[model samples]
Target chain A: MDTDLARERILDAAEDLFYARGIQAVGMDAVRDAAGVTLRRMYQLFPSKGDLVEAYLARRDARWLDSLATHVDTVGPTAQARVLAVFDWLEDWFARPDFHGCAFINSFGELAGTSPQVTAAARHHKDAFHAYLHQLTTAAGATAATGAQIALLAEGAMTTAAISGTPAPARHAKAAALNLLTLDARPVASPA
Target chain B: MDTDLARERILDAAEDLFYARGIQAVGMDAVRDAAGVTLRRMYQLFPSKGDLVEAYLARRDARWLDSLATHVDTVGPTAQARVLAVFDWLEDWFARPDFHGCAFINSFGELAGTSPQVTAAARHHKDAFHAYLHQLTTAAGATAATGAQIALLAEGAMTTAAISGTPAPARHAKAAALNLLTLDARPVASPA
Candidate 1:
C-alpha cells in the first residue's frame, strides 16, 4: 500500500472505531484489521497507539471545524444569520443516524483524566471553536461575553441532542442565541 | 461485612475510580481493591460490572439532583432567583478539585453506545434535569421553550467547564440564563 494511502486508511478505521466504541475499547489490532493494513504497516505508520490516537484526534479536529465553517459560509448570509446558522448545522448533524456527540467533548470525558495529550487536544479544539463563535458574534455587534454565551448554547445543544436522541435542542439554542443577540445589541441609554 | 455497607463502599469506590479514570479503563478488580472488599463480597453485591455501573449512576443521579435542589431552595428567594441559582450551583461544582464534569455525560460518552443500561440511565438523568429546569422556569413565568433554552446553558456550562478546566462557563451560562428569563417573561403587547 502507498504510505500516505495506508496512513489515511488506518486513521479512517481508527476514527470510526474510536468514535463508535470508546477509545479504550478499540485495540490497535482491530484498527489494523479494519484498515486492511498489516500490523507491520500500521506500526510503521503510527509507531504506538498513543501516536495513532493523537493523529486521529488532530485530523478529526481539523475536519470537524472545516465542515462547520463550510456550512456556515454556505448558508449564513448576515452576521446574525451566521450565528443562527450554526444551530441549523447542528440540527442537521444531530438528525444524522451516525451522530454521537461532540467528539472533543466525548474524548475528553473518556480520557482527559488519564491522558494529557487527550486533554490538550480537547482543549485546543474547544478554544478554536469558541474563537470562531466569538468572531461571528463580534461581527454581529455583540460583546465577547455574548459570544461565549452563544457558544455555550451550541455546546449544550450538542450534548443534549446526543443524549436525548433528538434535534430539538438545536432549535431551542438558536432561539436563545437570537434573544441574546437582540439583547446584547441594544443601545445603552445616555443619562437624561 | 454488612451487605448494605459493602454495597455503599463498592459504589463509592466505583464512582471515584470510574470518574477519575474512564469506566473501561477501571476493571472490577480495581474497584474491589479501592473499596477494600474481597472478590467474593464484591461479586456477591454487584453480580457483574454492569450492575455496579448502574448502581453508581443511579445513586449519583439522585444525589446530584438533590444537591442542586437543596442549594437552589436555600439561595433562591424568588422564581427568577431560583432559576439563576442553578448556575450558581454549577459554578461551585465546577470549582471543586475533583470535578470531572457531569457523570451522566461522561458515562454516556464512554458506554452508552454498547450498554443499554448506561443509555437509559443517561437519558433518565437528563430528562429529570430538564424537567426540573422547566418547573423552575414555569414558576418564573417563562415558557417551557425558554426553560429548555436555560437548561441548555447549564448543560453547556458543564461540558465547557470540564474541558476548559475553568468555572467561568457557569458565570457565562448564568448571565445567558438571566437574559433568557428576562426575554421570556416580557408580556406581549395587545394590538393597538
Candidate 2:
C-alpha cells in the first residue's frame, strides 16, 4: 500500500483500538498488529506512540465535526430544528455497536492532563460544537448570553447521555434547549 | 493505628492518587507509601487493588449521597429546588482545587467495561442519584417520567462539566432543570 494509504489504515486501527479500549491501554505494538503492518512500518508512518494518538484524535475530531456540519447544512435553517438535528445525529451515534462514548471525552478522562496534544484536540472539538451552537442560535435570533447557555446545556446533555447509558439526557437537554429558546416573551434587545 | 483507621487511610490515599492520576498508574506499593503503611499492612486491609478501589468508590458514594440527601432536606421540600440543589452541590465540588471531576465518573471512564466490582459500584452510585431524583420529583408533584428525565439531565450535566473542563455545562444543566420544573403550560402531559 502507498504511504498515505498505510497511514490511513494505521490511524483507523488506532482510533478503533483507542476508542474500544483506551489510549493508554493500546500501545504502538497493538496498533501495528491491528493495522496488519509491521512494527518497522508503523514506526515509519508515525514516529512515536504520542504521535499516533494525536493523529487518531485529529482524525476522529475531523470526522465528528464534519458530520455535525453536514447535519446542520442538511437540516432546516430554524434554530430549533438545527439544534434538534444535533441530538438526532447523536441518537444515531449512540446506536452504533462501538459507541462507547465520546472519543475526546474518553481520551480526556484516561489521559488526564498528561498530553497537551490530546487535551488541545479535545478542547478544540468541544469549542467547535459550541461555535456551531452559538452561530445557529444567533441565526435563530437569541442574545449572546442566551445562546451560550443553550450551547452549554446541549454540551452537558451529550456528556450525560454518555455516562448514564441512556438517551433521555440528550432528549431532555433538547427539550430544555427548546424551552430556553422559546421562553423569552420579548425579542432580545439588539446589541448595544 | 487501628485496622479501621488504617483502612480509611489507605482508601483516602488511594482515592486521592487514583483521582489525580489514572488507576492503572497507581500501584499497591504507591498506595502503601502514600498511606504511611507497609505493603503487608496494605494487603491485610485490602487484599487487592481492585478491593481498595471499590472501597474508595463506596466511601465516596456514601459521602456524596449523604450530601445530596442533606441538600434535598434543607431545600424546603420542593422538587425543583431539590433538583437544582444537586447542581448547587456539584458547583461546590467542581470549584474545589482537588476536584478532578466526579470520582465515580472518572473511574467509570477509566475502567469502562473492565471489572465487575468497578462497574457495580459505578452503576449503584448512579442509580442512587436517579432514585433520589425520582423521589424528589414525585414529592414535588411531577409525573414519574419527568422525574426520570430531570435526573438523567442532571447526571449528564455533571459528566459534561467534568469532561469539557468548563463549569458552564453544569450551570446550564441546572438552569434547564429549573426550566423543566417551572414550565408555564405543562409541556408534555404529565405521564400518569
Candidate 3:
C-alpha cells in the first residue's frame, strides 16, 4: 500500500483499540493485526508507539471538533442557539453506541504522568475546544469567563455521561447553560 | 501486621500508585513493594488486582466525601455558602502537590470498558456525589435538577483542572455555581 493509505489504516486501528481498551492495554502488534499491515510497515509509518499515539490523538481531535462544528452550523440560527447547540451535540455524541468518553481526557488519565507527548496533545485539544466556545460566547455578547464556564459544563457532561452510561447530563448541562445565558447575556439598555 | 492494618497499608499504597499513575500501568508486585507486604500476604488481603482497585475506589470515595463535608461544615455558615463551599474545597484539592484528578474519574476512564467492578464503583461514586449536592441544594431551597447541574460543574472542574494542570477551573466553576444559586434558589412571595 502507498504510504498515505498505510498510515491512515494504521491510525484507524490505533484509534479503535486505544479508545476502547485504554492506550496502555493495547499493543502495537494488536494495532498491526487490526490494520492488516505488516509490522515493518507499521514501524515505517509510525516509527514508535509514541508517534502512533500522537497521530491518533491529533486526528481524533480534528475530527471531533470538525464534527461538532458541523452540527452547530446546521442547526444553530442565532448566537444563543449556537451556544446551546454544543450541549445538544454532546447529547448526541453520548448516545452513540460505541461512545466511551472524551479520548483526550481518558488518554490524559492513562498516560499524562509518563508521557509528555500525551500531555501536550491533551492540553492542545482542550485549548482548541475552549477557544471554539469562546468564539461562540463572544458572538453572543457573553464574556470570555462565561465561555470558560460553559466549557466546564460541556466537559462535565462528557465525564458524567461516560460514567453513568447515560446522555442525561447533556440535557442537565444545557439547562444550566441556558440559565447562565439568560442572566449573563441579557441586553443592556441603550443610552439616550 | 494485623489483617486490618495490613489492608489499610495496602490500600494506601494502591491509592497512591493508582492515582499518580494509571491503574493498568501499575502491577501487583509494585503495589506489594510499596506497601511493604509480602506477595502471599498481599494476595491474602486483596486476592486480586481487581479487589485492590475496588477497595482503593471505595476508600477514596468515603474519604473524599468526608473531607468535602468536613470543609463545608467548618467554613460554610449559610445554606448558600455551603453550596459554594464545595468549589472552595475543590480548589484546595486541585492545588495539592500530589493531586492528579478525581480517582473515580481516572479509574473509570482506564478500566470501565473491561471491568464491571470499576464501572459500578464509578457510578456509585458519582451517584453519591450527586446525592450530597442534592442535600446541599435541598437545604438551600433548590430543585433536585439544580443539584445535578451543580454536580456537573464540580465534575467539570475536576477533568479541566487535571488536563490544564491548574486550579483556575475551580474558581470559574464556583462563579457559575453562584450564578445558578442566585437564580434557581430565590425566595417566593407570600400570599395576601
Candidate closest to the true structure, highest lDDT: 1
Across B60-162, the per-residue lDDT of candidate 3 in tens digits comes to 9999999999999996569989999999999999999888888888888888778899989999999999999999988988888888889999999999999
* Tens-digit lDDT string for candidate 1 (B1-192): 889899899999999999889888898889989999998999888888998889999999999999999999997569999999999899999999999999999988888778889989999999999999999999999999999999999999999999999999999999989878877666323333
- What DockQ does predicted model 2 obtain? 0.30
Residue pairs with colliding backbones in model 1 are none
Considering only N, C-alpha and C atoms within 3 Å, which residue pairs clash in candidate 3? none
Q: DockQ of each model against the real complex?
A: 0.62, 0.30, 0.53
Q: Rank the candidates by TM-score, best first.
A: 1, 3, 2
Candidate 2's docking class is acceptable
**TM-score of model number 1:** 0.96
TM-scores for all candidates?
0.96, 0.89, 0.95
What lDDT tens digits, residue by residue, belong to model 2 across residues B82-121?
Answer: 7678778777776667666667766766677466687678
Give me the runs in candidate 2 sitting further than 4 Å from their true place: A185-192, B163-166, B184-192
Candidate 3 lDDT over residue span A125-155, tens digit each: 9999999999998888888888999999999
Candidate 1: misplaced stretches above 4 Å?
A187-192, B187-192
Provide the RMSD of all predictions against the true structure, rounded to 1 decimal.
Answer: 2.4, 4.3, 3.5
* Residue A72 CA displacement from its true place in model 1, Å: 1.3
lDDT per prediction?
0.91, 0.73, 0.90
